[model samples]
Target: MMLDRVLRIVAAALIVGGTLTAHKSSAQDGAKIAAGEVVYNTYCATCHGDGLVSSGQTFDLRRLEAGARSRFENSVLGGKGQMPPWKGVLTSEEIDQLWHYIRDNAYQK
Candidate 1:
């Protein structure tokens, strides 16, 4: 009887812990997305369009696939076509935040 009771309690605790961890992770993602939006508006909105909506002149960021992180990073850092290199202009953290924001709005996801 006692073993069963202890097991139940442990299982409940594990479930609660997992729930809390997921909530924390979601909150962190939200913050990063928000920060990334700010960065995008400041630097990329002119060419990329507001909210990742392309004006047909530049690439549509929303078309980026879920696995396109490396492609996005390379393009941003090395510059693609008319785009200038942002290697020294944007920080790594900003890049990561931008990725998170873009992924959150990607067509695949």
Candidate 2:
């Protein structure tokens, strides 16, 4: 009873730890965020709106919540709020690269 519970707790910890480790490693190897600056400047700057600082209701990309990364990416690719979707405009790889850029420069602390 007690031993079984302890074993289960240890197993869960190992699984969770392993998952976290893998995710961190993968995120670290994601695309070069600096390269994203040029891309953002070209396609995203006007509305987003100035220097990662917006003049409108555009959410500040430099100050994203850690968990909001996916939702932000979804909104970018599929559109949300006041912004139009870029689903067909940009490839999935571009979207992913943008995510890495934002995640590294803003979200992850």
Candidate 3:
């Protein structure tokens, strides 16, 4: 009887803890996405267009699927077609943030 009560209480606590953890994780992700937007606007907005909207000349960033992270990285680092390389210009963390921002606004998700 006592053991059953304790188990129920423990289960409830675990559920509450998990909920809080999920909320915290979501908040952190939101912050990262926001940071990525800043990086995108500063560096990529010129060719990529404002808020990932392309003007039919450059590639539409939103068209990139979720599994295209490696492709995106390669293009950004090496430059594709007329796009210039960003190898030494942007940090890896900034790239990651840009990915997050782009992914958050991606068509797949």
Candidate 4:
């Protein structure tokens, strides 16, 4: 029936749309993470170490889990322990990119 055919076409279109959206999101995340890496190397490598690898003297960035975004942002913005605050130095978008970079290289992920 024409109704059945139309329903099948609608379902397929929905599935394809969802897939494309997910793919686009993933690609955007990858781009953000790459940009974040550049920012990290410029600003954080001195203390955080290269490629998120710490030398035991500093906190290992890779140890941060996925659910730690809020904590991460808070610490970076307000400063944590000995770490200096980056609130004035970095924009929110830059911070978000840094988070994506960190999350991408997380040990657990």
lDDT for 79 in candidate 3 is: 94
Which runs of model 4 end up more than 4 angstroms from their true locations? none
Candidate 3 lDDT score relative to the true structure: 0.93
Alpha-carbon local distance difference test for all models: 0.93, 0.75, 0.93, 0.94
Question: How do the residues 1-109 of candidate 4 rate in per-residue lDDT, one tens digit apiece?
Answer: 9999999999999999999999999999999999999999988999999888998999899999999989999999999899999999999999999999998999888
- Evaluated against the true structure, the overall lDDT of model 4 is 0.94
Clashing pairs in 1: none
Candidate 4 global TM-score: 0.92
lDDT of 3 by residue, 13-71 (tens): 99999999999999988998999999999999998899899989889999888899999
RMSD of 2: 6.7
Winner by TM-score: 1
Worst-scoring 10-residue span by lDDT in model 2: 29-38
lDDT digits (tens) for residues 1-109 of candidate 1 = 9999999999999999999999999999999999999999989999999899997988989898888889899999999999999999999999989988988898889
Error of 2 at 42 (Å): 1.8
Where's the lowest-lDDT run of ten residues in candidate 4? 50-59
The TM-score that candidate 2 achieves is 0.61
Prediction 1 global C-alpha lDDT: 0.93
**lDDT head-to-head 1 vs 2, winner:** 1
Clashes of each: 0, 0, 0, 0
